[model samples]
Target chain A: MTDQATADLWPGERTEAARRLLLAAVESFARRGYHATTTRDIATGAGMSPAALYIHYPSKAALLSEISRTGHRATLDLVEGAEAASGEPVEQMRRLVEEFTAWHARGHTVGRIVNNELHALPEDAFAEVAELRIRIEDTVRRIIEKGVARGEFEVPDSRTAARAVTSLGIDVARWYTDRSTESPEELGRRYGVLVLRMLGSAAA
Target chain B: MTDQATADLWPGERTEAARRLLLAAVESFARRGYHATTTRDIATGAGMSPAALYIHYPSKAALLSEISRTGHRATLDLVEGAEAASGEPVEQMRRLVEEFTAWHARGHTVGRIVNNELHALPEDAFAEVAELRIRIEDTVRRIIEKGVARGEFEVPDSRTAARAVTSLGIDVARWYTDRSTESPEELGRRYGVLVLRMLGSAAA
Candidate 1:
């Protein structure tokens, strides 16, 4: 992976060793799930000793919390950044869905870990992740609400619409495979059009 | 919790003891995930010895394969039954989405186990489960195709639209909570309408 992709996958982990451990944890967790993966497995995947793993992360759950928090924060940033781009609601929604879908597809391992491994998080960590999730949903809802207000979209319920939009993007992580014909960008474009149709947008 | 619900969750597991074991496996796998869950945990959940659990399920993977197979079959039966119902394309699509979404919500635990834990299944088991999933997707696709043929819907790509419909429903298993305001049926109804809108139906 490129440095930029690495940073995108696990943002703000500046230390190379720490980032390597985090990446290893993501792969192990994605393949075997959080509860099934051991510190030894993670350490081995990162080419480090178990003690070295602890030097970076205090416990397995700590590693999970860090990954969950960083992944959620990255996605939240992506959505907010997409929304901040100046455009009509339709264009903004299109861009938001496209970018969000591509990100999930491209970083599916981290996406799956962040999404499917939430149950393994410590209570406080789970709550922190939940807060990021709500903010992300609200950002999508806000965009849909704006579209409805401007008469560009016909949505019965912005909250439900937001959930559907996010669901469409999030589900990509669960199903996307390397053998799949569509690239992340291609899938994003298709979803962008499909989501527009879903919202009853004239632009669809 | 009802007998009917039990049968629906794990169809064809006739013996009461086996059904109990299956139910126990579902709970353990859903809570801790497949790889994390031991057969001993499943047996304990079912109030039996590990030896007795083995008599019914050869291994933990066997239990998961059964759950995965049964869940996929149940959903495939649901989509096909929905299609076999007498209705216009719009109503058929509505019923299909409604029932599929409600099934996932009501049986969220089994749904999660089936959809999320496929990797834990043995190779042949995974392929078997994949076949059932494809049938389910194809059933939805055929319904959408019929709607387009009958001039009842305006979907650009039936395959992608079918995927979106199933994705919307499958995701409910991941996110639905008892604390949520909407009941399974209510969420299903909401999704039914949203799907129609997604297809660009006049009824939407």
Candidate 2:
């Protein structure tokens, strides 16, 4: 596994073994998808036995839930962090788009599973992740709302505009490849400028 | 299956049984993903035997290839059709975004599979679909180029702009649900306006 992959696992995961299992699950899920990946596959990828896998994660679903929850929380924290960093609405949005888009590009494998594989999550786990998703959306909407209030941006519908911005960032995971010449930071800067134009900010 | 679902199948599929199998594959791939779904599951969904399914599609990969090829072709046609119908660049872009985004929203199940499941296709089939994807991107890029040439749009990088626009539309499939209060047409219109602003269009 690449050091980047190892670093992307939930930093709060206390045990090295559990972090290894989570990284293994992400690789298997990203390669074969959540439904196709088996507990044995994850264990094999991690160089552990299925029985040993149970010590870290009770089931495949639990592993997925933990990944989903951690990924969503990271995204939420990124957006909120960007929001808190800037007093200006345009700068806040730029930071939000830049960091958020870069996060997706950098951790695209985890982002793909977090955004796409939640359907496989158990009900309560799914709900927990859904709540985080809502917060992310609402946070973006609130940013746009503040922009409109300050007359720094013009949008007829804050909700849809927020969705479009978030969608642009989220879909980076769908298509980003290491073969691409652009770095994640470059892609993030490009998207940040485009998003300003998208929001009708004069600063664009 | 719903009438809309049946109608979305490749109309050129000559036999009724072939269309049934194709539709079943789309539904199965969308719900369980391409990797987890089996030919047996597809045949069962279509009310046919596995042996009977082979009479039409040679393999599950074949079914997925046909779906991906057909869906990509339709998108190409849609983008080209919009381009053909408009002489003005701004109008051309509006129509492109509206139709393209609405198509993804309406056929989200097939859209999801066509966009996300192509990784499961055999190498030759994946190459074939990749060619179509490149054409779609090129066509959109050409439209933006025309807009830039006429000074109807101002974008520092047309290629990335095209990518962001297409990304916005394609992602509708990931998040769109019947539960959404916005209809596909309305969502498309909303995106149409947002895309104009994104492109730095004076018409916006």
Candidate 3:
């Protein structure tokens, strides 16, 4: 089953049917990757006939588009929420790294689908997702810019630092697993300090 | 067409027939990805029949395995060569980041196929590639460790910092483009500084 935070992002869609179908698609896309996974495979994984899948998603690309759009919205919300929280720049960054890294690590299956399956979305959907991604990057970049202006951070370039910090967190989806000893929270804590240090902030 | 560095990596096999097939595989796999590409497509791209593809590669998976293995070895060699060059730890780190990032950016098509298509590799081959990957990580980690030990770098965690640094470069493959106006050399120079700062080294 998916975690509470990830599930909560899709509120009002908890009808049992949609949940099973979406969850099945996420797992299949994560395991076999988006290109290799078929709609029939997703339907079978969800214990449904192949014909039943179309009633919900219309097509495999539609399923991917929906997932990507939802994931991007959730990510944008998470980053923006962290950015808007009441705090000094340092505190804001720590919270941002913690939430971003933990989200990628804890909900890694969906994270993989969201991050790695972008190419699978139809052209129209990809444009929308790209705009959302730009907003997400801008949010992080603004935080870093504020930190530099406040003299709370001293990176050579705020934009590049933002990109590196984000890349550090997004990569958790590629490598994190339950078998690892580090919990999502623990990884978040570690990365928060590491990333802050990268920005020339002293460790907390 | 692939870049000169990528082409030169596969020297001694530059016979006309082999070059066309291999280059076509790299481009197709990079564009459409491995699972989505059929041998037929690759053959057509190379100006050969589908059956003719078998004369060079036993199967489509074999083609992927060859590309993945060759790419991994090439990457491993590149990173190791950078690390082993004579310099202080900080300078070594700079070279490593510059070369590594430039390679990923310049050869991003092959880089995508090599880094993103790992799951398409067969089990035994994956194990070998995995070992090479470990060595590559170790090479970077050891440089950071030496830097920390010698007081040349002051990272809270060498292993985590190395992972972050590598993740930063690997991500260029996902996002870099010639149309972006940031040349590979410029990107490499910028990243080299960011990574050194991450390691607590002063700018090179």
Query: lDDT by residue for model 2 over A1-204, one digit each (tens)?
Result: 332633665677468889889889988988889999999999999899999999989999999998888889889999999999989889999999999988888888888888898788999999999999999999999999999999999986999999999999999989987676778889999999999998999898
Q: Could you give candidate 1's per-residue lDDT for residues B1-204 as a string of tens digits? A: 322343567556478889889888887887888888898999999999999988888999998888788878888988989888966788889999999998888887778778888888899999998999999999899889989998888876788788889998999888876567788888888888889988988798
Pairs of residues at least 3 apart in sequence or in different chains that clash in candidate 3: none
Q: DockQ for the candidate 2 complex? A: 0.89
**Descending-lDDT candidate ranking:** 2, 1, 3
Model 1, residue B97: C-alpha shift (Å): 0.5
- Number of the top candidate by lDDT? 2
Off by over 4 Å in 1: A1-7, A11-13, B1-7, B10-13
Best by DockQ: 2
Off by over 4 Å in 3: A1-12, B1-5
lDDT of 1 by residue, A11-117 (tens): 56458899889888877887778898999999999999999998989998998999888889889998999888966788889999999998888877778778888
Candidate 3 per-residue lDDT over residues B1-204, each given as its tens digit: 676656765788666766778888887876776777888888999999988888888887887777778888988888888877966788788998999999888887787777777877899889989999899899899899988889888876677777777877887877776675678887888788777777877553
Against the true structure, what is every candidate's RMSD?
A: 2.2, 1.4, 2.1
DockQ of 1: 0.72
Candidate 3, after superposition: displacement of residue B27 in Å? 1.9
Instruction: Look at candidate 2 and tell me the lDDT of residue A170.
Output: 98
> Per-prediction TM-score, please?
0.95, 0.97, 0.93
Which of the two candidates, 1 or 2, achieves a greater lDDT against the reference?
2
